[model samples]
Target: MTTQPPHASGANGAAIDLQHVTIAYHRRVVCDDISLSVAAGSFTVLVGANGCGKSTLLKAVAGTVPVAAGTVTVEGRPRRAWGRRELARRVGLLPQSNVAPEGILVRDLVARGRHPYRSALQRWSRADDSAVDEALAATGLTAVADEAVDRLSGGQRQRAWLAMLLAQRSEIMLLDEPTTYLDIAHQHELLELLGRLHAEGRTIVAVLHDLNQAARYASDVLVVAGGRVVAAGRPAEVLTAQVVEEAFGVRCRVGTDPVSGTPVFFTESVPGAGG
Candidate 1:
């Protein structure tokens, strides 16, 4: 039985809205009739077990994946109403892995973010240079602007990708499993950077496997299970021990982080959790 999660709303109004949205891959359903809202400037994290469609949902919002039914509304407009370049200017997506062209300089890679602003006959302008420069500086890559992207450290490479998004000046950023290959320290570094971006008033939606990390960084959490959102709210409200067990099938105890005062948990078993 699917327990309907309440409609998510942002205090500043929605940046993205999904109305009875259903998504499928190769004619097989992934997410079903989901209604959710991503509030403007909110840092919302999607947490779920493997293959639960969190990434697919992000792609739908980015217009990379088509919904089998229903609608996706972005910035108060139906998704299909916007032109490709226009939508690219508004929403940016960073997938799980990015491969820079062989020996491509960091500056060159970040410069590509300005593609949406270009046309068949347009030449590179000072404004494009300014955006790329500002993005490199903001992401702490100015010193390495001339370095090849493949030469950067894991954290730096991720930041390089993020700089591309920043250069796009996108209002809504959808990141799928951004922390996948980073070490503990680098993970903190990237998450902190995202925190700063959210503080600057850009909307952030990410798919993360670490519920604890999600709890610490997210302004709101959505627990996805069995192709549906089972819970949605603040970390303190929705990431309870019972919710964790139900979504992940792990026995755990929920606690508060001494530093951030966010919800934290400890697993006790590898098998079933009491329902």
Candidate 2:
């Protein structure tokens, strides 16, 4: 059984909402009393130091990790209230790493993402096939769709995983370090793909380690420090020098991106180090 209030696909309401959410593993709290709302169609990035609970908070929103306290909702309904398939249809998550079966073909791996829409009685439909094909094409893997996933280069493999997420066709996407092992070119490619998706109005919430990249692409930035939100707002407002230093314990100078006019910063361990 499932109750639907509003679809997560628009700019109407919060795509994902965490209200005083606390997440812990084995009684060790990672995020405590964290409250934030990801507006629908917003490209939001979570930034912080390693082990600062950015991924933990994202997992909580995705319902992958159990929330120790408070509530998490997608489209104004409690996460637990949604059926598993319903939840999958509403939100998709891409973790930092995913290991596919060594011999599995890229197309087959991407087909797995459509499982949420299938059941015992219902089999593969043209819609599902089309979705898989579209996802592959969108990720530039159409030519290599039949190739073994393990044989692909790191960037190709990352695109394969992303193709699977695209095949899921969820309105809200939660990504944990989506650019993990890619080279600079691949990273920019992936970011451009994300930009296209955001333009199509899917909510994108990602955990990113690159402050300048996040500022360039994200509509909103959330700075997490010591398991709590230190700042949240537009890139210019949230990615200031003080906030960056507070979240990462690093000195930085903020500047505008020449092309995008977004806030870009250069970090320094010592004063005038970049000079």
Candidate 3:
């Protein structure tokens, strides 16, 4: 059995910290001996091939998946040490997929984010209402506030779900493929919204599959491969040709994007490689 040592808080401070953590389902290990620290107020993006354990690591940090070893902390405190409600108030997770109840109105769905703030005997307060409204406006969902979530387009639904997380009012945002299944325009829109949220001082950690998008938006990039971190640092430093080829098993050219000036990848062509 692998044992994790006591977790020491980051000297620079962190919003989410994982120390020598391992995640497994049954006996199949997913992520092994991983140590990661997301600095407060950072726009950190996780990038890797599918099934590389990036999403699993994110879930582990969100406390949705139990860690087989090591500790995950929020604001320097063990995640499990915080009460459920307290934890919910500190970290909000926007899963890749969220299925709301049938015919659930958007505002009502977003209002559920305030569950941690309300007890059985307590009614909704003015603060709750304010948070919900603010989240709706922030995500530009006020236009569809009355529509059922099931009736909205994919991008709108994603924004609605994001609104709920915002209403939760957590300091750290853990999003898994939040822009998945959306068209290019919608994807950019959602990323812009996240950028705005980060600008407001929320610590954002997201798993993004698009390497270009990850480099374009991320203040920090973590590249995962074979269930471990292959590279982690600033996008420019981490998304090198060597790291990209090592992680993705493809040769690629890494250069500055003409538009954003961030690193962009161009796959090296192999003649007759494709059957």
Q: What are the lDDT scores of the predictions, listed in order?
A: 0.88, 0.88, 0.87
lDDT of 2: 0.88
- Screening candidate 3 with a backbone cut-off below 3 angstroms (N, C-alpha, C), the clashing residue pairs are none
CA deviation > 4 Å runs, candidate 3: 1-10, 269-273
User: Per-residue CA lDDT of candidate 3, range 1-275, in tens?
Assistant: 01112222345578788889989999999999998889888899999888889989878877889999999888888888888888888788998878999999999999999998889999889989889999899888998899999999887888889899989988788999998778999899889978877777778899998999999999999999988998989999899988988888888998898999999989996435865
lDDT of model number 1: 0.88
TM-score of 3: 0.93
TM-scores of all candidate predictions against the true structure: 0.92, 0.94, 0.93
Per-residue CA lDDT of model 2 for 130-244, tens digit only, reads 8899999989999999999999998899999999999999888889999988999989999998988888888899999999899889999999999999899999988888988
Better of 2 and 3 by TM-score: 2
Best by TM-score: 2
Q: List runs of model 2 lying over 4 Å from the truth.
A: 1-12, 270-275
Model 3 residue 218 lDDT score? 93
Worst 10 residues of 1 by lDDT: 1-10
